[model samples]
Target: MIPITTVKYPVNEFFQTIQGEGLYTGTPALFLRLQGCPVGCPWCDTKHTWEKSDNARVSAEAMLAKTAPSEAWAEMSAVEILNVIEAQGFTAKHIVITGGEPAMYDLMPLGQELEQHGYQLQIETSGTFPLHVTENTWVTVSPKLDMPGGYLVRPDCMQRADEVKYPVAMEKHIDALDLLLKNCPPRQDTIIALQPISQRPRATELAMQVCIERNWRLSVQMHKYLNIE
Candidate 1:
């Protein structure tokens, strides 16, 4: 077993940016991207965060130093993080908790801390681990398929998801989505989105067609296509 003591988060980068997916899409938010993922998605754009040890580990203060003050960041305790958000003069109330698979960490403290301060917490996860989070937090579980360092996305993860944002490149990915959905209890409010893999137009066409036929939603990586970080 990898010793928990040796497991320090790489934290490749963090910044304030408009959230680019799911229900909170287009909302200006603070992003805390903890680095390290075991569930490998073949097309993961942020694969740079895959290793916990290789990337430089720095204090949250050092991480914040790389960005602009107006960009809204500071090395923060749960309480201190809230203060920084208030100080930033941001009117947006969303807080996005993303990562190289944030489910790898016990995020209860961080989630509870954010909620106490009135911030709506949204977690973008690969659903490889059983999630431990506050009841009110919104979960976007983007399920992973067979890849190196193979991990099974637990059934509980899908059942708990507020949204299932599946990435698609071809029929195999759609098959994976169908398999996952087979286990999830059908509900009207359960959001099903097909995000084109890597903004490919052919893939987008497939996703759009499926969305139109099933009354599901399409999740375009608008941030990438729009050339925003």
Candidate 2:
């Protein structure tokens, strides 16, 4: 693990966009996508981000040229990141610290700075790493079960999440979610969301039924539907 304070994180990309999933869906947000992930889910859209070495480092200006996917990234410190965000003139008050597993790095410094500057912080993680962020940070744990990486979702991560979002592509996926939920701490306010995998008809149907049966929320990837990043 890298030292949080001194590390210049390998940033895959960063941009202002609409919150396309989970509880913050539809909200304006600045996405700070970090690099490197070992939790290799087969259905992962950002496959280019799987390996840190796959991307050559670029300037923050070059990295933000477009919101589209790219095999390019940059290294930036916490303060440098804030500078880039400021330079971009993003008005979105929400900051989504996402990944290639953003939890792959200690995020307390960056998250704390963003919160201190009045930005609402949210972390989108695979629930495979021990989460280390401020208490106010909204942790969204989208547990990846039996993925190619063979990493088990950490029970402490699920317990820490404000929302547990499950991507359902089949009945077994739902079953996995049920088993994962058993490990979560009994919190009345903990939100459970069932997101259909890639908006597939069968998956959507299954997710809708499960959400209704369990009284969970449905999280369809709105960015994919709206043709946005």
Candidate 3:
């Protein structure tokens, strides 16, 4: 096996922030945003992360100092990452691995390093890439349907998801989710959460109504509303 210190991934941004959505909402967490994604959801908030450029790679300090989202990233091994986290003095014990599709890179090394030091790890994924994190990692699979990228949500992802946080903008979105559920069923105990697209009033209303009717959870992005991170 390759040493965990030798297995590196592109690190876009690493900071301390409150969990903005899904099941871990409001929880203080360390956010690790990886760089690079091919799943082109037109509504992607972090479009800057969609492409990885060799020229854009910078030092860890440069990546962490970014006040705005950009394509700039650092190539970091699991060991180097832990050192930065500790040096930053972040109080959060929960770490959220997010991105331009975090599952695009194997996370076992990262997961092992974090969990060994008593940190809880979570991943917010689009359900397009096969997961390679530790079994103990909390997996939130946000199913992206019929996006421009044309990537299909894997059935194995649905099965592995601890929560299915689907984004909905209209009744048709809910209809699509229903079809997906029928075709690629999640575990019986998986939490089903609906997040409104861009928090539009109509979208929020539709999400709320559907959540009420289906007994699913509604995930309002509190961080966005509270002006945090």
Task: Highest TM-score: give the candidate number.
Answer: 3
TM-score of model number 3: 0.98
Pick out the ten consecutive residues of candidate 1 with the lowest summed lDDT. Answer: 68-77
Q: Residue by residue across 52-136, what tens digits does model 3's lDDT show?
A: 9999999999998988989999999988988998899889999999999999999999899889988999999999989999999
In angstroms, give how far residue 147 of model 2 lies from its true place: 1.0
Query: TM per model?
Result: 0.85, 0.93, 0.98
- The runs of at least 3 residues in candidate 3 whose Cα sits more than 4 Å from the true structure, single-residue gaps closed, are none
Error of 3 at 17 (Å): 1.0
Of 2 and 3, the candidate ranking higher by TM-score: 3
**What lDDT would each prediction earn against the true structure?**
0.74, 0.85, 0.93
lDDT for 205 (candidate 1): 95
> Candidate 2: misplaced stretches above 4 Å?
1-5, 66-68, 184-186
**Model 1: how far residue 101 lies from native, Å:** 0.7
Clashes of each: 0, 0, 0
* Candidate 3 backbone collisions, by pair: none
lDDT of 3: 0.93
